[model samples]
Target chain A: MSAAKKTALCAMLCAVSAVLSTLESALPLPVFFVPGCRLGLSNLAVITAIPLVGAAGSLSVVAVKSLLILVTRGVTAGIMSISGGLLSLAVMLLLFRLARFGFVGVSVASAAAHNTAQLAAAGLLMGDVRVFSFWWLYLLLSIAAGALTGVAAGVIIPPLGRALGAR
Target chain B: MKKLSKTPLFAAADIFIIALVLALAAVPFFISVKGAGAPLSASVKINGRDAGSYPLDNAGEFKLVGENGIEMTLVVDGDGVFVKDSSCRDKICERTGKITREGQSVICMPGRISIALEGETGGADAVVG
Candidate 1:
């Protein structure tokens, strides 16, 4: 793909991710196990960006989404969201390099990392280790939802990749 | 020369790291297994008007008025807090479960209603800020 086209695609993905995150935040899932966790649909954009734009591009998308949410919301929520996004991007990039487990594995791994990162961030900010007590249930939910989203991305990315001729 | 094609040690390190995270995630279920009796009781007010005080005994049922002139029943158990019933088309708040412990919250975006377990900032335990 041409440089201009690649930039546009990346921007579009970032926008979609931001909107998804905002909407998901508004609609909090009533999980039976983990109380405060959500599906974090924006992560789909982050994971897909890994294979397309590489680490820098994926990180850029996360940064953009985090900043947008931070600017719109206050610092408390922004800090937790940004921490999760950065951590998810880091794990996804690493896993993408190591194994060809396809998009499904990447999504699941990123989602797990996202929850872990958020809980860790909360513990750190609150100065209490008990904040991490919700990790198990949230991680399971993250993995399950991440796999679902990753499968959807896997199915969608190929055609888009071929049409855009993304290498 | 064929013996030099060993996989990088970093790959093994990655597997180890992932395993460690999964294990850490499971620790919560074991540690938080102790059922914490109702740790909080407070009055919920909207726009300076008395909605109601959440009863500590049950800790599973409460009421609040929404912006649309409708009432919402909230429930909290050991797991979390949630809206048992609401008049909104979107049952988003109902999906967010009941939060009993400190630092957990359930919000009704459309109704502009929020029920939160106040952090250790102040209560009967300490002076309110």
Candidate 2:
């Protein structure tokens, strides 16, 4: 694909991810294990962008998504979102390099890494390690959240790639 | 490039990751439960410094000032402690709900404050002699 086409596709992916992120926060999920934990539905677009737009494109999607959260949530939340979103995209790229793992594996691991990174960021910002120990349940919830996003990505990515004429 | 496959929602690598995460997730629960007893108090920390600790039965609501001049209202009751109000936008601390178990806590990341339930430190392995 041409550079312009890739840019357009990345922009579109970013828009979709931003919408997903907004939608997720608006939905009241049946979660009690941890505070502020969501199903990471926004990550579905990033996962789909992995094969269609590769690392750079996916990174933009994550960046835009975080930026949106920062504007909507607050400064601290924005920082956490960027840290978590970047780490998540990095993990997804690394998993894609394996070339054999499915979307579920990558999305699941990415979701877990995102939550871990955010908690770690919160701990560092607060200058405390206790946050990790206190919020261990967040990691446990990542599995189901990751699978949900992965399933959505799995259904959308193939068709999206074919339509976009991507590699 | 090979596209992400859908037939197998979970592959060998996914299973391995799930196992690893599950084991990691269980570690904290084990540590928290190992030395716990009936919680008797709640301790509040702001910006990594201990602000104060009160009896679990303190049964009153009080405000705390944390880093960045963040204000949080914490409620301490007979059964548990929780954030009644917070200045942070997300209100995650407020949503953490009441924590009753020893070693459990409610934290406000934006406010840089944490409220943890504290209990007596004793175990069956302790020897009277």
Candidate 3:
């Protein structure tokens, strides 16, 4: 992809991810009843970007989202989101490259990774690993959230590729 | 990235992954629920500051003043510690009921107050004279 085109794609992906996260936070779902649990909706944009933009562009996508969060939430929240988002994006990229894991499986893995990283970050930030007590429930919810995002990605990616020649 | 597969989104590997994650998450959850030590004391914190610490041996009650002059009445009984009365509108602290084990806490977010039950230091308690 050309420089301008790459920048445009990265910008769009970042905006899409930020919007998805904002929408997710606005909607209070009981599914997130467990502490440190979110739907990982923003993962969709990053996953889609893997096949569209290269790894570098996708990394920027994650960075932009974290920066947006840092500005809006606070320093601590920004740190947590960056840690979790980067890990999740890396795992998803690896799974995509392997070509063995399917949509649901890869999404589930990324979501699990995201939750694990967030839990670890929170434990470190508070100076108490006991915060990991919520770890199990967070991962359990990841399965469902990942599957949902995977299905969403599946539904959107094909149409998007055809429309924009993403590949 | 690989070619986006045409197969159904839910694959057999997905089941295995889900099962693996579920099992992995269950271990810590059950351990935390088991809570090794016994309840010994109740530590109160208002907005991340230690308000007071009290032994949970006998029944007692006290008022906790939190941010914005939010007042809450904490009751410590044999069962554990809980919020019996709260000036906060939500009353979520009261709704949390009682906390009887270590790491258990009743938190009032509106007031930024929390009453947490601290368990015994070790599995066995030392009787010091």
Best by TM-score: 2
Model 3 Cα lDDT, one tens digit per residue, B10-47 = 66767877889989987865555443446578877666
The lDDT-based order of candidates, best leading, equals 2, 3, 1
On lDDT, the candidate that comes out on top is 2
Q: After superposition, how far is residue A5 of candidate 2 from its true place, in Å?
A: 0.9
**Candidate 1, superposed: residue stretches over 4 Å from native:** A30-34, B1-23, B29-129
Say which docking band candidate 1 falls in: incorrect
Clashes of 1: 8
Q: Report the poorest 10 consecutive residues by lDDT, candidate 3 chain A.
A: A125-134
The 10-residue segment with the lowest total lDDT in model 2 chain A: A127-136
| Of 1 and 2, the candidate ranking higher by TM-score | 2
Per-residue lDDT tens digits of candidate 3, residues A87-121? 99888888777766777898999999998898677
Q: Which lDDT value does model 3 have at A28?
A: 53
TM-score-wise, the better of 2 and 3 is 2
Clashing pairs in 2: none
Candidate 3 or 2, higher DockQ: 2
Candidate DockQ scores, in order = 0.10, 0.54, 0.34
In TM-score terms, candidate 2 sits at 0.90
